[model samples]
Target: MSKLAVQLYTVREEAGKDFIGTLEKIAALGYEGVEFAGFFDIPANVLKNQLDRLGLTPVGSHTSIEQLVDHLDEVITYNKTIGNSNIVCPWSEVKDEESLELLVAQLKKVVQRLQDEDMILLYHNHDHEFKKIGENYLLDLLFEKCEGLYAEVDTYWVHHAGVDVIEYLMKYKDRVKLIHLKDGIGNELKAIGEGTAPVKQVMELMQKWPIEWVIVENDEPSPTGLKDIERSMICIKNQF
Candidate 1:
């Protein structure tokens, strides 16, 4: 079965105020793992020790393309120290064919480098990725051009793009390793089950796929970040 994790970007404010404390609360809320957005300047060893004590796995990290290109050694060392092997490129601008080709070249190199270190590079999607360039969706061309690049499909964005989320997932089934299980209505984000992004259906498919993690994310958390995720966890637990 796929494990549960939360993208820390959902609770960026809380994490900014108290990084370790926020992680402790996430652990208490029954999330098995965490996908980090930023380290908040915390030392990797100290962060690892806390994660170990809290019994939370380092699911992945959303790293910037610049860091991966210029300071990959530092990125690797820090993530390795924290026991994380999956490095995700959270977003990239692919406005046109020119930009698409540029990103593909950059990611190809990054992917190979990560492979050499036994780490995986995943690209997280947003609505823009669904925009078409002639016959193919930008996302399709991206994956096709950049061999060995894995996917971290964001369900909400797929829905926002007016694409059938399930169909999109099926299209990239072989390359999808992580899922950003999100929900929203139009442009507004919501806690998992509180919006219409086929949360239950995605959960149903979880058993059939070799997904590493189903990561919950709320780009704009309402009420409070903790409360939002707590409610999401309740809904997820009920599904099981």
Candidate 2:
């Protein structure tokens, strides 16, 4: 069975104000792990201590490509200390062929380096990745060109991009390491069960795919953010 986690980006403000307290609350909400967007400059040991105390796992970190390239060593060391083996480039500004090629080269090197250290590098996407640069989608080109790179598929964006979410996941199922179960209608982000995305079909696919984690994310949560994810967790628990 796939484990449940929350992308901390959903509660960035609360986390920034009270890091340890926020984590305690997350654990109280019954999350098995967390996908970190930032560490708030906390010491690795201190952060890891809190996680250990609460029995929360560090699912992965959403480290940017720029950080992965310039501060690769620091990023790797911090994640290692926190017991996280996955480093994902959550977003990048590569709108054209020249920029895309540069990102591919940069990521290829990062992926190989991380692999040598027994870690994996992954890429997350939004609607723009589904846009075609030539004959292929930009995301397809990235996976094709960058060897050993894994995917952290965001199902909401894949649906927003007018693609069949399950089919898209199937196409790259072998390379998928994590999945974001954000639901929404068109571009409006919503809690898991409150949107139009094919949640049932995707949950069914998880049974066949080697997906390690299914994370809940809502860029804009309604009636309070934490409460929204709490509701989402119920939806995920019922579905899975």
Cα distance off (Å), candidate 2, residue 43: 0.5
Q: What digit string (tens of lDDT, one per residue) describes model 2 on residues 31-63?
A: 999999999989999999999999999999999
- TM-score, per-candidate, Cα-based: 0.98, 0.97
Q: Give the range where candidate 1 is weakest over 10 consecutive residues by summed lDDT.
A: 196-205
Candidate 2: segments with Cα more than 4 A from true spot: none
For model 2 the TM-score comes to: 0.97
Most accurate candidate by TM-score: 1
Overall lDDT per candidate, in order of appearance: 0.93, 0.90
lDDT of 2 at 19: 85
Cα lDDT of model 1 by residue, 1-240, tens digit: 799999999999999999999999999999999999999999999999999999999999999989988999999999999999999999998878999999999999999999998999999999998889998999999999999999999988998999998888998899998999998888889998888888788888897888879999999999888889999999888865
Scored by lDDT, model 2 comes in at 0.90
Clashes per prediction?
Answer: 0, 0
